[model samples]
Target: MNFNKIAAITITGTVLTSTGATLAQTTYEGDEFMGYASTGEAVVVTSISGYFYGDYSEYRDFTYTIGNDYIEGTALCAGGGTKWIAEGYGEYEAQSEATLNMVRFVCEYEGELQ
Candidate 1:
């Protein structure tokens, strides 16, 4: 019987046991993390529009017009629902010789905010 062989076998078994213990602990921690994430707020898709008429993920027929005082717009949302009456503002850089501007808007469903 070789002492070296016995020592090597013992060491291998110890390493494998330690690795298994670590893996079990990590798995438990991962499950706990997933449970916490699931409880948080999530966006639910209320409905899908343009199911058969068109692509449900694409917005179409969007139109906007700018006036001196206000900006008005309307669009067919991907869910097939119509989104209109978006309110937004524009930022202009007067110092820049080139045209530089940005517009941002928030749309309400059915033109109403709940």
Candidate 2:
């Protein structure tokens, strides 16, 4: 094969490979059901905490959107008597069918984390 033709073919294959990897990391396909809540089911709280088995735990806040309806809440994890925070979005096609699509999550930490 000529040098130019071989180079072009290598580049095309690299591009396709990278594109597939990107999609695989960002795609989700599965069914995971976790209970359900009725409308107008909410409570006021000063703070929230949960038990997570780890030395470090992150608190994630999730935001879901479906047409005109949307839901937003915090994802909490407690460990080492302290809370860490990490933020990201969710991508699950089946979840969109059940309720709103979880678009994103953002978290902020206050005080010093132990």
Candidate 3:
């Protein structure tokens, strides 16, 4: 029947539209810092040498298949040490700027002497 065919087409179109929206990609970039702390230290760690600093950037292409409320994508860093990774969590954010937040730790290395 004509009514049945039209109903099926409508449902199909709605499904496709929603799928495309959820699969959309977003990118974010900001300064990043990488560092480690002692397990037994009770003192607050606040020194320039304590942490290696740099820029953090990433591309969130799709939702992670195995996790809840998580996304996976490529990540990059720039500054004293340059590094890249194929897959990383998209929910890392140390400080918020605009609509995106700065990644906490994408890569780690010894910073150059000033």
Candidate 4:
């Protein structure tokens, strides 16, 4: 197996598999409690819009250190019909105006700032 010790054991197993994928990145390195503010209260915004749903994602520029003023609202489908215009911060988002089968992002971010 001596091809220079099998090329130094294949370069030390490719540097320990790239340092165990950078220590197994779990994404949102902020220790997600939904990043703060939004508690275990669960979510909802479906006063009638076909029971809403959610799943919006954000991390760009990454400044969500916990802003309770989680603004960016305006999605009113389920009869009132306004359906998404501003979203992305934290707490509640991902209720895509009813395509059903489930991506459920019925939305709310006002539960933060406590």
lDDT value, candidate 1, whole model = 0.21
Q: Give the winner by lDDT.
A: 2
Give the alpha carbon lDDT tens digit for every residue of 20-58 in model 4: 112211111121233122332322222212211222131
- Candidate 3's C-alpha runs over 4 A off are 1-68, 79-102, 109-114
Return whichever of 1 and 4 wins on TM-score. Answer: 1
Best-to-worst ranking by lDDT: 2, 4, 3, 1
* Candidate 3 structure quality by residue, lDDT tens digits, 1-114: 111211111211332232211221222232232232222212111111111111223222222221122234332433322222325433332222211211223233123223
**TM, every model:** 0.18, 0.23, 0.19, 0.17
Error of 3 at 65 (Å): 11
Cα lDDT for residue 72, candidate 2: 44
* Candidate with the larger lDDT of 1 and 4: 4
lDDT of 2 by residue, 43-93 (tens): 221232222222344444434333334444444433221222222433222
The number of the candidate with the highest TM-score is 2
lDDT of each: 0.21, 0.27, 0.24, 0.25
